[model samples]
Target: MIDEQTARERVVSAADRLFYARGVQAVGMDAVRSESGVSLKRIYALFPSKEDLIVAVLRHRTDRWNAGVTDAVDGAGTPRERLLAVFDFLAGWFREDDFRGCAFINVFGELGGGSDRIAEAVREQKESFRRQVADLVRAAGGPGHLAPQLVLLAEGAQTAAAISRDPDMAGHARAAADTLIRCALDDAGEPAAAA
Candidate 1:
């Protein structure tokens, strides 16, 4: 028998898959119950409401997504490569058969204006992505101000890749990022710090 925590995870995982594939409003609680194989009573007991379940799923996805990106960055040879590695990470993600752009972007577009909880979760995810970019920028000795632009590029690439159905979007974004980083280094007049 699955424990409560395991059962909860199953619910969240099923919800995450459904919500990402279909808009939040398009999916129903019964669908989640069916997909998760958790009893309907237990599902409601854990989430209380559909909105609560949505929030839980968003939080769970964000945690897992960030961990994946963080691991990719951590594995890089240098802080700068780590910066580029973000795009590499995205490239891998974009190439996935199930890739439908970013979950944060999709969820936000689906429910941002109507749901305060969802909006807050979306904001947190975007902020965390920027924070990761900012850390890379600082480590690479780039201008402190480039984090926002980097985030924009990263986001734009994801949107474009999803819409255009082109996995090369990541490659294109990586080139742009490299150019931006190089320019920053040239502007800083510091001999491109090793790696």
Candidate 2:
């Protein structure tokens, strides 16, 4: 028999795959139980309700994603490199066989604007991402307005990769982002491109 912690982890793991692959609304608790190989009673004991489990899953995924992006950006040599690194990360992620689309976006689609908690969580995650990018741009000495444009380009690249399965979108996104960063630098009366 799986321990309580193990059962909870299994439930979360199973739900993560299913929820991301399919949509949150499309996957039921029964499916999670079966996929996790845990009994329904144990699942209930760990998570009081499906919505509770959903929240947990979203939080877990958000944390993992944020960590990944932080790592990717931090490893780069310059702010412009860090900014473009985001697309590189997405390009690689979209190539995975299990990759579908953005989990947060899929969850939002599932909820259809109904759950305030889910909506808030999604908003917070996006806002964090935006802030992270903006801060990186500011630190790199980019103009104030470049952050928003870079964010849009990053998001657009993700959407394109998700729909078209083309890693080249990352290159295009990088080009656009680089152009914005250069413009920002130029506006700030500094070298327009990072070394």
Clashes per prediction? 0, 0
Error of 2 at 95 (Å): 1.6
Per-residue lDDT over 40-127 for candidate 1, one digit per residue giving the tens place of the 0 to 100 score: 9999989999989988998998898799889889989876688888899999999999999988889888888999998999899888
Q: lDDT of each model, Cα atoms only?
A: 0.88, 0.81
Worst 10 residues of 1 by lDDT: 186-195
The deviation in Å at residue 184 for candidate 2 is 0.9
Off by over 4 Å in 2: none
Return the TM-score for each candidate structure.
0.96, 0.91
Off by over 4 Å in 1: 193-195
* Candidate 2 Cα deviation (angstroms), residue 125: 0.9
